[model samples]
Target: MKSNRMVLVFFILILTLWGCEEEKANKEVKTHGAYTENNVAQKMDKEDKNNEKTAKNQDDNNSVQYFIEEEDFQKFAKKGLNPFGQEKKQINLSSTDFEYYIHGMTHQKVKAKEKWDFFEMHPKRIKWLLEGLEKTKYKLGPDKQKYREILKRWKQKDFSTIVEDHNFIWDENEGTVGKATDRLSQEDEREYLESEYEMMHHFK
Candidate 1:
């Protein structure tokens, strides 16, 4: 009976030790799982913050910075109106205003009997317009480079084929001169101008 009691005690101790080891193993597995899940959550949060920062930076870069007031820019867009007057104030022009000024000059060139008359009559006006364009910050890469080339030409006072250049641009984009006059209605002309403006500057 003593031997039987010793065997029973040994078996019970072995069972107790095995149960303790099993419990410890289960606890370690639970702790490792929790740690892994926390790490994954922290990684996701960091990624979300990085994405938000990138978006905010892009918004700041894309926002337009104007050189002049909105009202003054609109005033410069009026047909047949020259922005540079006899009494010259401090010249402030935006990229949009520069394009509008070009459009007005082109219209004047088309109306004048002598092609070079407008350039001759308003040399100071032309000079101021060019200076304003040089000073203005351009939003589009293509437009900036294009105007730079034109500025180089105009600075040399070489406008021999300006009318041809105007006609070619109009013809290639919209239609022939005859089509513009006879076929295009007033609405069509307005739409064309609006489309052209949007294409050039990516703004309305």
Candidate 2:
């Protein structure tokens, strides 16, 4: 019986030693594989930051910046704004500017078939345009020798060529420019002025 008791105690001690060795083995285990979660998250964060930076750079690239002085910028803004061209304000501008602006306004208004609905629905803009032309005549052109000689004796209101009964007078009732306002577009103005090239000979 004593021998059997000793054998049972020995078996208990072996089991205790085996449990301690297993615990130590578990503690000593070192992982040898790659770091998966943290490394992946860090790489994704870097990629996200790079993508954000690239998008920001692209947005900056899309902006156009022109370097110019304030006066030049303002002047450039005004370039091509006036479609009438410098011929309208030129020193030696011909009579065509006055006649063309007068008639061109009619061309713009006559297309508006429904706004006024007058006898034939003529636009009031045409009349406003004619009045503007008459007002602009007071604005002087280039003081060239030919212009000076012509205006010396012929005032804008009295010239037969400019104020003739069939052109200058605005007959809204008749839808016409009377005698002085007969000259039409650039082409018509050129041809009509050529008809009076003999009158211009005296100025020469």
The candidate maximizing TM-score is 1
What lDDT does model 1 reach? 0.49
Model 2 C-alpha lDDT versus the unseen true structure: 0.39
* lDDT scores of the candidates, listed in order: 0.49, 0.39
Writing each residue's lDDT as its tens digit, candidate 2 over 1-204 gives 999999999999999999999987766553212456657889999999988866754553344121223454345347732223222433333354434443332331122222111111012322333334345435544422333332332222222232232223133234422223232433443343353344445777
Error of 1 at 58 (Å): 50
Q: Write the per-residue lDDT of candidate 1 for residues 1-204, one digit (tens) a residue.
A: 999999999999999999999999999999999999999999999999988866754553344232224454346545434444222332446544544444444443232222211111134455666666556554544565554555555555444444553444344345333211222233443444454445545743
Which pairs clash (backbone N, Cα, C closer than 3 Å) in model 2?
Answer: 91-142, 165-179, 166-178, 166-179, 167-178, 167-179, 167-180, 167-181, 168-180, 168-181
lDDT of 1 at 9: 100
RMSD of each predicted structure: 18.9, 26.4
Give the CA lDDT, 0 to 100, for residue 125 in model 1.
50
Q: How much is 10 displaced in model 1, in angstroms?
A: 99
Angstrom error at residue 89, model 2: 46
lDDT, residue 168, model 2:
30
Q: Where in model 2 is the C-alpha error above 4 Å?
A: 1-10, 21-37, 62-204
